[model samples]
Target: MIDVLPPWPLLGAFLLASLLLAVTPGPAVVYLLTRTLAQGRRAGLASVVGVALGNLGNAVGAAIGLAALFAVSSLAFTVVKYAGAAYLVYLGVQALRSAQAVPQQQAQTPPATMKTVFRDGFLVALLNPKTALFFAAFLPQFTSAAHSPLLQSATLGAVFVAVAATTDVFYVLMASLVAGRVRRMGRARLWGRYATAGAFIGLGAYTALSGSRGKA
Candidate 1:
């Protein structure tokens, strides 16, 4: 497997770039943080797993030339991108509605089940076609011409996903620690829910309005 990768220098550069990208806050990080604050550490971790799997699926799609299809077909990319954005907005709306329905006494408890949280996370990641495009555009930079392109791309994509998952886990842990304090204050908890909902809505709007180019 090592032989299929680029030279040591290029590999090191790739690792460094991946780490930097993983640490930078993105849609995934925002979603995880909100999930952690609203639910708990377990839900946040489950979301991480779901998102990782979804991202892995996108990486595989890139390896198999799905990203190439997206590159050439604007309609395909737009359709999937809008779908993901709409879902995020829907989640935000549902959160707001739920917040109003639940009594203040129960505001501290997580309203959604783990399965729902994981499924939402999975859908959020999977529906974003730009992720596959990103893998297609980014992975080839560190791949060697002498090796099988498929193997190199797949390996690099997996490595990037692993790095990203590690960072996401760290974010979840930190958010969980802070969540205890946030939950203690009734007004704060209510406001946290509103903030979470707003974040989701804002992220969705940004995703919908942002340029179509593959962004890290």
Candidate 2:
């Protein structure tokens, strides 16, 4: 609600910070680019939607105190973090297997269904406990003490997600252009599959190993 928002100057600062954070190359950006280059624009766009939705969920979760739960309970954080990492590894393995199963002549066949792609993206983003923690930590900095903290947090989270989604869509469009060129080369197509798989697997490892006390 407008009443919960911080002053215009504070809101402007928050928007500026959100834009910078959204554009920074991070796990989400890598995921988007890999999906676009490997699967196509449709999958990439689906992934963007899925991720955006997942992020929105985290924002809501933060507003409702889920982040505090994770912050206090190491077990909860570890369980969720490992689960997410495992899922990423599973996706990577699936990509490799799918690539092998498809014959060279069938390369034109779609790598995965849009539903599957969307689900993968959603789960990947949702499972990252750090994302929830990030929202919990980040949104409070711009909140006004005189207003409802919960509403302000949720509103700012929504705004941040919107900015991130816009940047993600741009990344997809750029990656799609490169993918068009890669499609013309059979070897490049095969390599693209491997690269996608590697990216996912590597991200999984990174997530699993990263410190628990930090922003996503």
Candidate 3:
């Protein structure tokens, strides 16, 4: 992939941008926070694992040329985009409903089993086509056909996933800690739960409405 390598300055800039994008407040971060706050550290870690798997899957898809297929096909692109949009809206409504219910409920519940947690996290990531698009677009600026496109994309994707995973794990652990403390008090717990729900809804809306997109 060295043949198509961008100039060092451009490559460094792309990598930096990818790191920033990974940390920005978005569906993944919001989900991590909400899960951590609601379920605790173990469940939150499970979710993070699943999300990491999803990111790996996206990277693999990009490496293998599946992402290019979507990029070239407008119909396919629309289908994937709308599917992601629909899922986001569904998640938003669920969060809003849960927020409405949490105030009336008095006790916090135990988290799900690791299996169920993993399944939920996996499904959420698997269904999100936007992640693949991100890989497709983000990697190319650092690569070209002159290089081994697959390797370059894979390398960039792997770096991004590594940085992002580390950042998300930190979020998960911190959120879990704060949430555990907050849950001891009733009103604080209620507000925390509400805030988590609102974050989800806001992320969903942003994902659905935002026009800025990486090439698929």
Candidate 4:
């Protein structure tokens, strides 16, 4: 049996952690699903691409000294992390309050242009400090100080992005399917807003609590 798996158990750790992380609800999924149900699949996919690019940036940061820099500088890391936490909370509060700005069953109206969608996606992911910290914490588990960690961590990050795209795309498709049928129902749209809002709140709370915790 030619040994194939890396001698590092941390690779498996990274994979498991990535899988769990992908399943967790975040702004990426919410943005994708909202765009899909509001605009269309193409727009949603563009958003996914932007998020994947952002994740790629995270991987690059890990490969270079960025993650290490943050790890070493507690003040910098804390600043970014808390800022991210506050942002998530702000999004949650906005979602909860969005009930008043727009009428129900209008999510499908004023479809988002592709350019707007991509720009929104890019900005959302780039400003998201949680994703940065996520890469910082998760990438190191799959590599070691003695080994060349850049390529390995980048590969792991790619895998994570692939999984996230698949997971979130599925969510968009499912939500879009439901949207087509439920758009006629005012109550259904309201439920979706409430659900998305609640997910945001839960994610924000989790991000705030989980700050700076290292797994594996």
Candidate 5:
């Protein structure tokens, strides 16, 4: 196993890049933060694991040839991308409606069970064209021609997911910490709801409207 792995220099560089990218907030971060702010740490953490698993799944697909399939078909990419965008929009609308429907006192009602959070997070990450394209493009660069590309890609993807999961836990903690203060203020709570909805909608629109991702 060790012999098949990438050299230390390549692995080190990949890990560093993954760390930096993971810390910088993206759509996944927004989703986790919203869950934390609206619900609590447990919900947020469940989402983290779900998204991480989804990402790992994508990396595995890329290792196996999903990247090649997409590379060969632009229409396929467009279809998947729009489907993901639509899902995000649906979530945003759902969030807005939930905010209005749930009474302030009923905040005790936990709508996001761990399984629900995990499922949503998994679908969100899995359906995201950006995430799929990202792994397709990103993983191949660090692989060595001397080794089996599939093995190298799998190892790199696993490492990337692990590092990303760590960073996600950090964001969950930070979001949860501020959640208490936000909960105390009615106005803050309302606006936070808006912010989460807006973030999801904005990202969805962007995904729906964007042109084809340049290869890699």
Candidate 6:
């Protein structure tokens, strides 16, 4: 409850969300696993760090854009922000309550030095449309109006990058250990959906009860 990143509930929720996303063996995790299986563990680790930096950049951009809106129109931001968060939470809940297919695919990148691997991974992830969209779409739901918007944005970005890197490292380990079953673990996403939905609900409830809206 020290509230280093956001308020305790949001911080906890973000951490849970980050962990769920990271460990779910989604696109990013699958990408890392393929790299490890094809090239080597070192390359996979490099890619992990590189992708993390790229995601950080995306998160920062999204955070800045959203925070600037808050500065310009607190009233509009209030309406849009809550509405968007609610919609996303609804989507997450629906996903949690539904069953979905988890398809597996990986892009091939030739073996290379750690630096090249890192650079390629960085560029690839930085340019990924989903990264930008996801950060802008989801990160603001946890922001605290009590803090400076810029500070909150940066902290969330940093935390997201850190959590992603750590989780990617685990995928790299598993890939090295057993490449054949890496994609087979897609069932993990089912649990991740639950965790993500729970986090969303927790965040929405926290925002409602914390009185941040009244202060804002």
lDDT of 1 by residue, 1-216 (tens): 776677789889999999998999989999999999887899999999989988988998998899999988988888989999999999999888877877887775656888998998898898889899999999999887888888888888999999999999999999999887887887888887788889889879988998855563
Clashing pairs in 1: none
Better structure of 2 and 6 per lDDT: 2
The number of the candidate with the highest lDDT is: 2
Which parts of model 2 have CA positions greater than 4 angstroms off? none
Candidate 6: stretches off by over 4 Å: 1-4, 66-110, 179-216
Superposition error at 94 for model 5 (Å): 1.1
Candidate 6 clashes between residue pairs 3 or more apart in a chain or in different chains: none
Which 10 successive residues of model 3 have the least lDDT summed? 103-112
TM-scores, all models, native as reference: 0.94, 0.96, 0.76, 0.67, 0.91, 0.59
How many clashes would you count in candidate 5?
0
Question: What's the C-alpha lDDT at position 116 in model 5?
Answer: 86
Best by TM-score: 2
Q: Can you write out model 2's per-residue Cα lDDT over 1-216, one digit (the tens) per residue?
A: 667777899999999999998999888888889999887899999999999999999899999999999999999999999999999999889888877887877788667889988998898889989989999999999997888888989999999999999999999999998888887898778777888889999989988998855667
Candidate 4 lDDT over 1-216, as tens digits, reads 012224556556766777787888765787677767655678778888877777677667766766676767877666766665566566567766775567764654454478866766665665555566667676666565665677666666777888887887778777777666665666777666666567656656665577353421
TM-score-superior candidate, 5 or 6:
5
How do the candidates rank by TM-score, highest first? 2, 1, 5, 3, 4, 6
- Using TM-score as the yardstick, the better of models 1 and 5 is 1
* Regions of candidate 1 where Cα sits further than 4 Å from its true position: 108-110, 214-216
Error of 1 at 5 (Å): 1.9
Question: Which tens-of-lDDT digit does each residue in 1-216 have in candidate 6?
Answer: 233367677688899998887777554565566567645688789889888997888778667784344445657545644654454355346545542433323222133578876875675466443455567656778876776766676778788889989988988987777643442456543444455456545544443343332232
Candidate 3 regions exceeding 4 Å error are: 1-15, 89-106, 144-147, 190-194, 212-216
Clashes of 1: 0
Weakest ten-residue segment in model 5 by summed lDDT: 103-112
Global lDDT of each candidate: 0.88, 0.89, 0.72, 0.67, 0.81, 0.62
Which pairs, if any, clash in model 2? none
After superposing candidate 5 on the true structure, give the runs of residues whose Cα lies further than 4 Å from its correct spot. 103-109
Q: State the lDDT at 189 in candidate 5.
A: 72
Query: Considering only N, C-alpha and C atoms within 3 Å, which residue pairs clash in candidate 5?
Result: none
